[model samples]
Target: MNDKKITKESLVQMPHEDLAALVFNLSTIIQTQNEEIANLKELYKLRTAERYSSSSEQVGYLFQELEILDAVLAGQPEVEETIEVAAHSRKKRKRANACTAPADTPVCDVFHTEGAEDTMTGKDGIVYKRVEDKTINKMAVIPRKMVVECHHYAQYKALDVEAGKDNKKINLPAKTDALGASPSLVASVVVSKFDDHLPLYRQTEIFRREGFFLSRQKLASWVITYYEEL
Candidate 1:
């Protein structure tokens, strides 16, 4: 039989030289596979150590010395003392942002020119308001009531009263209905609900406090109508 066609049962009948050659080839293949597995495990360990390591491993003794220097400087007494410190200079602090008042903003000036007497004495001694400290503070002023517009249109009928004859009666439409709401008002309500996350029922209560009896159902209808028209 050919050597290529030999089975496990015919291995015992094979020549000693051919059997030794087959064993050597099988051993070489197993050794190559084992080396590949060991290389793969080593590469995995290196990658894991590089990626998952803690940030503290990067902090060295130099950073520790800087932190100790900062603490020692901060704990020093306010009085002058002959103490030696590391030659470390801190960066200058940045200035505050420049603030400009709006052109339309109304400015009201208040002066505290008058001084008051201090009756109580402190550890330093009695202190009175000698210098004036002027500071600017911005605040908002809410209106007592929201503006509600009312439009009135007068109607006149032309009659031939000279001949004592009456013409057909004509009625003119009102400038504003009982609802008396505007497009801007509806827009404000919709923005407050969606953008501000306010509910219609809460809006209704707010309107009630503002001296307007608004219903959530009406506001809901307005929202639906506004979207539908858009």
Candidate 2:
């Protein structure tokens, strides 16, 4: 018997008897390995089933079956029992009241005065005078409005150059060095960023919706400037 492993090239060169023996040994080894693998798979399935399977027994007859009831009441006496529950009363729910604005809130009065033609004339030929006014309070909101301020400076030129008066132009100095800086605009940005928790990019979108194209970078610079100044 040959002890060395036989390759395909060696098998082709071997004798007919040796080639037959090699084929038989290879087929037997493959069959044994397949059997071991199948046994391992079955053992693994059995172990998994045992480890995770529930220990409780399956319910045979849910206590509603006549056989279960007879077994349970084999030696017990029959008795009647009654249960009484107390009555409950539910409280009536209160309605929410309308909230009133503060006393200091600015009120805008809309007058609906009677015109001359619509004025009432009594049957006794007497004209009716205004006695009182009826007012209805309704909560109103004024949306934010974008406004552009145009500053025009008047130029003065000296008509008489012969006199000591030379051509000197004077205009009111701006509140700040910034070109379009306003208290209201800055306050709005600061409040929206800090109090309302709105980001500069979102505020830019909001401004775009209002037809004002303000870049997020410009808004960020303004916020930084105001933060430093404060």
Candidate 3:
């Protein structure tokens, strides 16, 4: 038998007799391996079935023994059993009061007076004086509002023509590097994106709904510029 591996190229180069012998030997080896694999699979199935059958028989025997024990106990007289437990008391839980808004938070007062009058007058013609006012604090949210701020710089000319001085103008207010975006607006964008987990695209849509057209690219630019400045 040839000990060398028989590839397509080798087979083509080999003589007919050697090739025929190699083919026969390979087929015999494959048949024997397949038979061994089939035998192993059958043996595994037999062992599994035997294990399952023994476990089921043991369980059935246990159940039969329990039934016999139950019948024997039924023939005996019944006896009542009592258990003593110690008395115990549980402490009542105290409820916490609702927390009020922070003192620093801005408050908007809405007064509801009697009879549409600021002061209450009695049935008698006597006048009433204000003593104290009842106030209720509630947290409120104001929706985002977009407004345009126009800056007008006044130019002043020198009254004396002899004075060689340039015209004076008022200083402009401080603003962010991002075009058309204020410091507060940029801060809000940064908080909304990082803290509130809102995406730039969603913020753009929200701004659009609020009648302000802000592109996602523009918002991203503003956020990046603000972060870089910080």
Candidate 4:
């Protein structure tokens, strides 16, 4: 393989000895560049403090430093990475190539489980019921209800209390469903502000610019949580 050609394919083709030599050369160049940086820093400090007697001396010193700097930098080798150009362009997905899911796919279902809902949580957390059939409503315009059957002797006492049925007799538990805004919306708002480097106040201003109202305090907290989660 050529010294410069280190793409995945070329790397595979390189002889072991040549690859080892390339690695050593790259490491040596990195060290040389680091040393050159230190030397330049020292030179900068020394020249800035001195009051030169003549413009010619100053120019002379500058030329000498330049020569030294060039020589040091020239001694350092350039570091190049092997790029797999052929593989890269193919892997990237374009919007035009996106696939859509089937429109008629079934999503919602109702199943009766021999388990008590009190096992999860309640207004007062407890479970005690022989059997309870409950319908959990879905969050949509056309909501689907999932029916779950409770097991014998429910896990907690509150299950019986919430179901509004005797522990002995089995009955369905009714729960009121009130749709609230999804937390995903808040998460999305935070993602835009933090990851995109838009300050909360600036984002709030942009919302104002677009004739949308968003509170600054809420934006600030969302951005904070967004970064913390990341």
Candidate 5:
């Protein structure tokens, strides 16, 4: 039956099974539309709250909303029982000794100690050296300029004792200019782009700031080349 013609008169004239089917279909459509509206409203509210509310307030609002949804789904209206939570205090962490360095990673230790001028006069009128406060801070150094290492192998040419012809010049040690970048450099760039969510254009800008003109296309090719190699 045409939707425009679905009046009470037409519905009443329909057979019992047809009327029931029509009613069921209309109910399902209404239910689906209601659910869609509810979802859209919820999304809008969440977006508004996230944009305008404080972080803590946003978290509380979302949590409370979730609790209400859970209660509604479970068909339970019981007031949630209040439980007194023990106050939580973060424990002070003990200082760790020097950390073991990882593979392919460089680590530096910076030591801070009291200077010779740091001294004290004891009650006995005797001057004594003050106990020194020493701390070893470990840090990874980010290079301001890209580190480009050139390995120069001394090329030794041996002449045949009598009838020398030059042996094909020893192929320089493994190709360093293969990708125009070191394996580590390529790997770092790839990880920074994919794992760290940095874009190639952003990386190119960063490189430019460091006095290098790396193009986005070049960086993209580096990623593609490494992927193909792998």
Candidate 6:
């Protein structure tokens, strides 16, 4: 098998234990390989960004460590949860300041199986709950809603039309007008991209290829705000 390269299709036919062991070993090798690639990529970025720092090496080391762990748990027939490597999880899309119900407002309580920390910490100290209300994340639209009077038919009809909610979202690599929009909001948008697996640097070039001049700094600022808001 040393002379033959493995493909994903072949891996599936192997026994569970064999597959798990092979996957673990392959992931470890990949992690080591990626460390060099990451270092090279970061070096070029630091040189271009002019924000050279000693932490680049540290970041590469951290990635290496992560790769090792990820490799060890790469494949298991009965794996409980899918492991993902990200700066933050995208599911944290709720607002902490949501108007939650009063503490003594409910009566029915249900106990469920325990899981990850994020799922529970958001509501109570439980992963899955019997609650209905969850926080919503919405883009800020200017010019709040207003009532429109419709002078039609026998009965008077009054419609409440929301105005600001129709505001267009500016994607990264897309210029955000220098309107005095909340800086924190901008940052939040940026952070959400990474949390959601949206790599903005690559997005920048892609946008530029399509005639947009988005700066990396602008994207970075948005990411900063996103995490701060969280």
Across 1-230, the per-residue lDDT of candidate 1 in tens digits comes to: 23476678868987999899888887998999999999999999999987997675475534778889777766754553344458854444433333566789887766654554434356888655444465877665657456767756454555566634454433534222334566788889988998987899999999898788989998887767666656
lDDT ranking of the models: 2, 3, 5, 1, 4, 6
Give every collision pair in model 2.
Answer: none
* TM-scores of all candidate predictions against the true structure: 0.39, 0.38, 0.39, 0.21, 0.41, 0.20
lDDT of 5 by residue, 1-230 (tens): 35576778887788999989888988999999999999999999999977887876345445677888766757744443344558854444433332666585865665544254667787899997766566654656687567877755556565655536764355454443456667787888888887988878888888888888988888777767767766
Worst 10 residues of 6 by lDDT: 144-153
Give the TM-score (vs. native) of candidate 4: 0.21
Best by TM-score: 5
What is the model-wide C-alpha lDDT for candidate 2? 0.74
lDDT of 6 by residue, 139-183 (tens): 433542323333222332234455455544333332333322345
Tell me the spans in candidate 3 whose CA falls farther than 4 Å from its real position. Answer: 1-97, 114-135, 151-178
Model 4: runs farther than 4 Å from truth? 1-181, 221-230
Candidate 4 residue lDDT tens string, 99-214: 45567755686787746354464468765554456677554446323233333432344445555664454342321111121245456566776688666778678767766677
User: What does candidate 3's lDDT look like per residue over 102-191, in tens digits?
Assistant: 768887887776555556678997777776777877778998677776646555677777657564444444334325776688889889
Clashing pairs in 4: 126-156, 126-158, 127-156, 127-157, 128-156, 129-154
Model 2 lDDT per residue over 99-210, tens place: 6788999989877774635356899999876666768888999997788877576667777786466676656454343536566787898899899989889999999998
lDDT of 2 at 198: 90
Better of 3 and 6 by lDDT: 3
